[model samples]
Target chain A: MARHAQKWRDAPALNSGDEVNKASQSMEARVINPRSALLSNYEVLSLLQELEADHLARTKIAHRIKKEEEAAGTDVSVPIGGGRPSTAVETLENLRTVSFEAIKYLSADHQSTTSQTPEAVTELVKSLESYGFTKAEKLQIVNLAPQEQIELYVIVEELEDRLSQEQMVEVAEHVKKSLAAAPSLSIVAQPSHKPLIVKADENWDATDDVDEEFDDQGEGAGVEGDLDMEED
Target chain B: MFNLAILKDTVAVHPADFGTPQELAIMTELNKKYANRVLHDVGLCICVFDLTEAGEGKVRYGDGFLWYKVVFRMLVFRPFQTEVLLAKVMSSDHNGVRLSLDFFDDIYVPIHYLPVPNAFDPNERAHFWHASGDAEAKQTELLDTPVTERMWIDKGEIVRVRVEGDEFYDDEPGPVKMAEGVQVVKEVQTRAPFTIFASMAEQGLGPVSWWATAQPEDGEEQDEIMEDG
Candidate 1:
């Protein structure tokens, strides 16, 4: 058994020299602090948006430069100052693709982020200071504008133990109020078409009876009110 | 969910990038190395947040590239355990559900983690909840139930899932194999380096539409229950 163990160790020892050489040749990146700070979805979205815009601007400049060179009758196929000119562009493209994917993922079905501003988020955070929620919980509450108590419960662990039902309701109310204060472009854009369609449908149905038409108009107004509330 | 991770790396900037600003060049090099890549145990790195420290550039004996040790904060997509996140259902099977956040598509809700009393329907190629009043109801009771009566977690539906855990697998190099006298490097099926385990068993989870439509009624029921309790 000892002889077998000795051979096994010897086999690995031979390969260790090669492994060390490879390790020294390529310096591996090290993680200093894995959890330095948490970033909200809104913050990430904005950062990605900025990166996307920068990529677009860079691409435009590169395109313009290429055009100028082509017009000047220079050999445009060959890169002008060639120290792997393609690498920079390739890296930029990769960044753009990744950022675009992340932005799409972050923004999809997340209407709260559309109108979320730093000021509004800070104000909301300040209002929820009394609850003594953790930073992660607060970030989540801000990211997902929890409209109901059930949604709020999912964000904050041990919800019943931490806060009473009334407190939960109050927190939800605070979130709703803060979200409402922010001017929502989607809410504004949403109502215009729905009410118009309802009105158009009512006109088609109640053309003959005047009294029924008035009643239908009142029903349409109620529907419009419900639609508006839902948008909020 | 995202977080800032401070990472240190030695970045070698090529002589070509010397014309650009030092910070810009370093930033570009860092992004090239880290962006869209998964760091074992750390998470998927998105981009460098900011450069915190940069050591003096060193000239190697032969290489023209200037190397600088950089310490920077990187924005990474690492959802915390039990954190609530909204993701779209990519597909469902006997195993459970697969979810996608567009950029990260390896999120999975295993069969055990799905809402209790849930079963996979082979006909629909999707898993669905029985939605029966009794949590203890058997699978046989749901067999005769109409399709509309069942709450289906269909594809393309947005769901709220709580992060249960995560896994990181290292794809280490394996020994080459010989097949029919020709040495064949085995075609290892590439797996996601980082995968998230999520659960949708709690209240307000599952498809967003499920709660969206039933929210008012659900709230009223909860209020009644609270009062009774």
Candidate 2:
């Protein structure tokens, strides 16, 4: 249970000095980098956000065109088939939504935060690297702020045997101490609304003015530009 | 959460265990073969409960071992759709929240299923639900002090989740290598044997604290009726 190796016979004898050393060595050797295990959380999210916003924006245009066509216009929407988004799109959107809800918080979101105190978490993450923790693992540790050894173990249980029980306990104690010393968690401001147009590329905005009465004018709901929102 | 399932398997008995009782030898061999393993049809095998049959051991041709057929009932944990469970929040992030039972830990709840009008606190690294009077919760809970409306699930908090579905992925092959002049297999796929896709998208679901204190939602004695680990 403490290690990932499933085959009992392959394992070094359960409780021996050599077995302990082999356990830790085998753990690191077998495990993959945490980054590879990352999900399509952020990419799929931003993609669906862009896709839905795109679909909605396009639908609004098609509706307006149809209304104008009724007066004295053409059938531009014919080639595009239906006014509604494609079934594939709808199905994917549903699956993505359901999957997103279920798989959320399991992985980190790609959006880099322009938090005022980024250095605190960054420093802690960097310090954790020396202890054989991956970047994702470190991020998780910083995020959790685990208060007890048992709680900390839950996060690293996949590789629990890699570090001695004493070492793990020490690390857990260190995490608790660091969290206690750090300032209280600050309030997170609501993310800015960027337009859906630039979602894929540079300077994408996610404005919430995705109403039907959208004006095809200067810019759609250009309230405040996301100054910090930029490409990595 | 718990169910009995029958398993049929053949066990190899070595001469080293000849001194031990045949039943004991077979039991040890059977446990070693199946414990902590996931079967596609049976979900996950917790332990061998009771043996229905332990066939007589037959000597092998060349190898100094006996092959025995064992029929046994095993305790399994295979969550069904809509099975409400009590789990602890393993961690929370912008994408959603992760909950874990002691035996299994890959349960997830996405943002869409979260309480109405919740936002991810990037700095805090946890998602929060802002129950509001207005349907469109324009104000951020962080800025305002809607104490009762603002419900947050921190790490390690006990949460109630319903099993939406479960997924099984065949263990991918591993790299082949030579060890001690013999071929060795390096298979370390951390893919969870049985990943349970669950949702906390209901009134009785979310953190147990809310439903535990407030009147039970949908009027179904949810608290007492929850069949969980």
Candidate 3:
């Protein structure tokens, strides 16, 4: 009991230190003021401590609710954090860190050895995402073991293959009709958009002179018309 | 330009005792043994025939024996090559540069070994390769595309190389397969930038320095954390 209490004490210190360090590093990257930047580390650590406490409290509450549900001999509709109850598998995944012992718990619950691997769970989640599964649905799938992942992979693969086969037939029909009407020539030549005739330098010079004279005459007429209108 | 007596003695002496005085002291020994003999240069090539026994030492070449091969004016001596990782850089002092290698061997590289007109700055990190000189583009690809500009350890620079993955060598240990989400395209040349970690940790080739990433002093300073842990 003493050793267990000591472990709990050490956990808070190490976790807080890591959290503070990571937060400080991230803040130091963006904060410009030297004084404010130093204080940010303290603020981040305080926030982390609060979050850790809250998480502990929530876990305790969840444990109590689960125990009540088990005693009641009915499906426990205990809302896990604002939503449905999380399975044992989901709870393990939320830890982020790989727990090698997670396989045993999953095998016991699922009664299937194949559904208890991290790889299987990851694959299952990926497949669920591909199948347009909601975030919560994907999360549920992600909480599974390797066996579950394999099952999800197989199911997703079969569905995708069927959908693609149907789409391919439709695409083939569309392409066939479109090509039949596409003007078929013996050579299948594309018409050139570039001008064939190149203008001579003399013609360019003449055009430039005419444009300059026309601009000058138009300006003179505009000024004369403005003068006449003002006099009237 | 050639010393006839020295040349004759070198050829007469056995290669096994290539560095001994018997092979080198031909002129001095000749004078001491027989003062009345007169010697003349017989062109560049002189065949000295000994009256008694062909000379106590003659030349031979084998392993552990130093043999001189005359290629034009230069003499070539074969030296063994060993590959070692840059383990640690000892503090720089006026005495010279010292290095501890992963092979548990420490060596002091004198100023002469350092290439003159060093292109890298004092603060800039450098990388060192087992093979020196400019790197040949052995292979290239546009995969994983570096998120930022990349730098590497040039030859002779002290840099960090993570040992989590396989060690870098010329030969492949397993069949090379394209990684996930990567495709090999033909007729297209690839040139992708790589981070220091990718080069050393993933590719298994480097002692790449991370000085540019805002933690230059942390290279040696991390020892404190390690000690605490």
In terms of DockQ, the best-performing candidate is 1
DockQ of each candidate relative to the true complex: 0.31, 0.02, 0.01
Estimate, for each residue in A38-135, the C-alpha lDDT of model 1 and write its tens digit: 98887787777655434443333344444555677863444576645531233454565678799887777554787676667788899899998998
Write one digit per residue (lDDT tens) for candidate 2, span B1-229.
Answer: 4445776666778765564456655755655655556776566654444566777887744577887777766545565565555677898887789887645677888777776677777665676665543446643645364444446667777776667788887776656778899987665757876788777666556765555435533224433333221
Q: For residues A151-231, could you state the per-residue lDDT of candidate 3 as single tens digits?
A: 233223243454465443443333233234323221101221111101111122223433344333322331322322211
Model 1: share of native contacts present? 0.68
DockQ of model 2, rounded to 2 decimals: 0.02
lDDT of 2 by residue, A1-232 (tens): 7355555645545445575574345323111111122211222233333333443443344344455555665544343534432111112322223323322332222112212133454455655666797644554465444444433543453556678777776666656555445353221221313332332212212123322244451233221232111110
User: Tens-digit lDDT track for model 1 on B1-229?
Assistant: 8999999888999887675657777888898888898999999989888888998887765588888888998999999998999998899988999999988999999988877778788888788776654577666766556665567778887888999999999997687788999998877888889999999988888776667655523535433432432
Q: Estimate each model's TM-score.
A: 0.78, 0.43, 0.16
In model 3, how large is the Cα lDDT of residue A121?
34
Model 2 misplaced regions, further than 4 Å = A1-232, B133-148, B174-190, B215-229
Better DockQ candidate (1, 2): 1
Please list the C-alpha lDDT of all candidates, in the order they appear: 0.74, 0.51, 0.28
Interface RMSD of each: 14.3, 21.9, 40.3
Lowest-sum lDDT 10-residue window in model 3 chain A = A31-40
lDDT of 1 at B127: 81
What lDDT is obtained when candidate 2 is compared to the true structure?
A: 0.51
